[model samples]
Target: MGKAMFEKEKVCFSFRLIDMGNGSQVIDESIKTPMDALTPELQAEYMEVHEQLAFMKTIQKNNRRETERGRKLVRNPLHRLACFCGLA
Candidate 1:
């Protein structure tokens, strides 16, 4: 990963791997982005953008759940109708 960073992003990042058990491992990574060196105003702006992205993700998740629930609702009647007609 460090080598890839040097080749692609041209930035130095460090990480370590910890073995859990049974061939499982976890990566503890630390990367310095340009945002880390931002000024106060820029940091605030970055945080605002981050918050907006989190909000959007949450909204998308709720929307997906609602859509799946709606699909189930729509299918339930058809399923019942099929069962009534001995087609199920």
Candidate 2:
């Protein structure tokens, strides 16, 4: 990972967390391996936005699938009319 180039208030923030695999959720020590410099706040914001976008994409995909299923379905005239209303 490339280091963060931007500096805030003349302070270059670098944060890294490592998991010890001891069934602990929180990381005790800082980054041992060299990683890209990134501010904790910036990384958190990036992750939050990334997760929100992923969730929105998932919802859109599901809605598209539902609409496609509605369109693909073929039945009697009454059923078709009912489904047409559902598509709207």
Per-candidate local distance difference test? 0.64, 0.55
Model 1 residue runs over 4 Å out of place are 1-35, 77-88
lDDT per residue as tens, model 2, 1-88: 3355554334322323444678643322342322235467756754564566579889999999998877766645777788689952
**Tens-digit per-residue lDDT, 25-73, candidate 1:** 5545563335445677856755665566579889999999999998896
Task: List the candidate 2 regions with Cα displacement exceeding 4 Å.
Answer: 1-37, 74-88
Best by lDDT: 1
User: Model 2, poorest ten-residue lDDT window?
Assistant: 26-35
Pairs of colliding residues, candidate 1: none
Clashes of 2: 0
How far in Å is the alpha carbon of 41 misplaced in model 1?
1.1
